[model samples]
Target: MEFNIPGIVNAAIPTRQDRNRNVMIISSNSGGSYNDSGFLSSDFPHSPAKLYITAESDSFDAQTLRDWRDEGFNVEYLPLGDGGSAYAARLESLAKSNNLGPCQSYGIIAYGDAASFCLEHFHVVDNNPEFKLGCLVAYYPARIPDPRGKFPSPVRAIVHLAAKGEDSIDVVGHSQMLGIQGSRRVSRRRLDRGVGAGRALDMAYPAYRYDAEPGFAEHDLDEYDRVSAELAWSRSLAVVRRALMGYMDADASVVDQNTDGKFVTRNLSQTMGTYTAHRSPHVTYMPTLTGAIDSQELQRFYSEYFLNKNPPSTELTLVSRTVGSDRVVDELHVSFKHTQEMPWILPGLPPTNKRVEVMVVSIVTLKAGKICHEHVYWDQASVLMQVGLLDPKMIPQKASERGVKKLPIVGREAARRVLQGFEDEEDGEADNELIPGWYDDEEEEEEKDEQEGKKENTGKKTKLQEEKGKQPEKASVGPETRDEDGQAETIPERAKSEPKEVEA
Candidate 1:
């Protein structure tokens, strides 16, 4: 799909190319004034195909709508007071009045924050299966701000571009997943489960509290740049255009606020400011000691521990969920387990570098093919507490209170080294304890076979007797095996049963 955006006026832009194929551009309005600098009107998309569906003046980016009429594109700017959510309904009514053909493929290019409303209510107006979607552009579309009910709309191809960010915290470990990369693409399933968009990553901004002070200006891009250039989110307009049009996935949250455990149905009118402190990937980590960890670092940790070692005898198990979508509206939850190690995190100390078995669960949400929210869980704080932080009490005040376990960056190397040393010591004593059991089983089987041969030579075999003899083994009962010559094989008493395990 080709997109040509000159600037943004409010959240809507103009598309003025009227050669052959005409694009149905719809703009939702909220009565915001359009700026001459950031508005897209005069120069529409380079393609010679465009149309505009706009709403009233004074109550929206009305000034920009006037320019569309002069540009010679088919301009049908209506007054929302004249037609509310029923605007599309009215369009349909008009189409029914006039004999219109499906020859004109349709597309939606939303400016300012009007795009969110359009996405929120797509299923309501145009429900025809024939109208899959030409393209959808939501520039600066705000997140779903409510948690009451849902307004579901899914276009085959949709793009959402936002200027702000959100924060996260829960049962997961403590760490911020920052973002400010040019842009990213996420799927719809991930919108519900939660993850990250590849583009806007490691940004410095934090989530603004729903109820911050009145003077907090949401437009502080300059201040952010001055404070830390890395934190600035003002990417080139062209880059943002690509970011918003990358995909049509629905794995993203409609609401930008906390998407869990509360009013999850509320939609916001606009974002007040940036949201920081992303949810760490440890929100759902819980399982047996032999489970798997799937992070890149965790895999490397195991390579250093078992695979690269001389004999490669250190058994490693890792449990993890593949990284995926984190959209609010539609999301996907994926989980897996294997044996591995963390060279940087120790089970009992801060992991500077060590490999150990672990489990991970990640929930990601995606919108327009980009991650909107992500939650993760792991075992870090407990390890540090076990090895000892500067002060167990101060290790991670919030994490400790919630019983979260994670290793901090400061003392990670020492803790991992200590854990590796501990592992080496434990692996050394199992030689005689585990290997002999296999040999003993073989010897016992041979003795039993000899006894069976002798019994066969002495007496006639009975069907009932044969079944009775086999029943004991089948039922896993009457344990001790002895030779027909009358001798019980010595059982190795090293180790036996293990404790039960669980996960979150």
Candidate 2:
């Protein structure tokens, strides 16, 4: 922080542009001051894009520079010892003055204090319509904090990749940055759900904790790096690069996290990357990731990121909760010491005495990486505790007189549900049912309108004719295969068939 970061940026000579567009990359993470070329050569977003990167490290005339030149981007290097602010201001002036290809872009990516280097220019980029400021991808962004407990900047349409676990601990020093309910955040690996590598990054996860059943029938996640894949180093890079590209252009869509084999229409963010367009009890709505967001929409995103608070806004409501992960072989072998939620009342087993740890770990095995065969090892009890569903003492409870202070604190909005058995237990529902991709409210409305239009086109068919009509000719339809929750999704828009009476 003592160095003139911008000053370092100022000294780098602009590379000659064969193409008009350019990407400006700044490498400065709390890990240590690195140079314009900080990430390892193999890191996904490292090269391939033609642009300039200024980092906090000592840049040597080496192969990386050669490799960058090979890719067509003009390479520039700067040392942090320069005039920080003046340097940064000058760089900003230079970037503003530079022109990219018609589709070319301007960007600044940071992992350390260097991430702050671009904050001053976010609003500036937003105003310049011609020069599309592509996505600002920040990894473990540091130093900036808001009084309301969220990221400080108004990141308009920027795709954020926040790596949890290093809240206060920087590269060398123990500087406190973000907090949780007035307390400085600390790294508790047992509680962290991080991969086996102790120093790896851990995402805060979603409202529904990921549960991977412990048998080989499920995936063996040796590295839970949060790439939506299991040990998929290459796939992780692919997705990160895709996001970086989308941030630069006007239209870019995130790959479907569930399956890379196919693509969905939705442009994705982190929360939506996993939950896009899926229908289910857990995710209530699909908020638009592309529109201009107001303060309220920003709040909803923050709440989902912070405490998982949802609703009361035009933006999609998310019942946010962390998605759990464990990639190391021995990392998750340790038992759950305590899941932090104070006794939360699960719907079915309200009055029971089953204080438990959540292990619906099946959901933990995402698709951006390899997936193990699950749907078989999912256990109800293990999942209940992980989600703070059935408290230990309340699994099968009666009116045991525990002091009010001793009881678990479930908020006032909820009136207590007395003990009851599972709602879909005997009826047969998977623990975490994969909400079908076709089940969004918006889709339903669109379907309804389409159906009404079809009815008008065909004119009125009688009740029997409509009910027992010939199969409405449609495309080659398929049956429901297993979805995320191991349940069959109700096929949307399946063509109807008629009943032909057979001779007795």
Write model 1 residue lDDT over 223-266, tens digit each, in one string: 22221111111121122222222322332233233322111222
Compared with the true structure, all predictions reach lDDT values of 0.31, 0.31
**Top candidate (TM-score):** 2
Quote each prediction's TM-score.
0.24, 0.26
TM-score of 1: 0.24
Q: List candidate 1 segments past 4 Å from native.
A: 1-113, 116-323, 326-343, 346-356, 360-377, 381-504
- Which window of 10 residues has the lowest lDDT sum in candidate 1? 171-180
How do the residues 150-268 of candidate 2 rate in per-residue lDDT, one tens digit apiece?
22111222212233433232211122323111222223222234344433323311101122211101122332333322332222222323323331111112212322211122222
lDDT of 2 at 71: 27
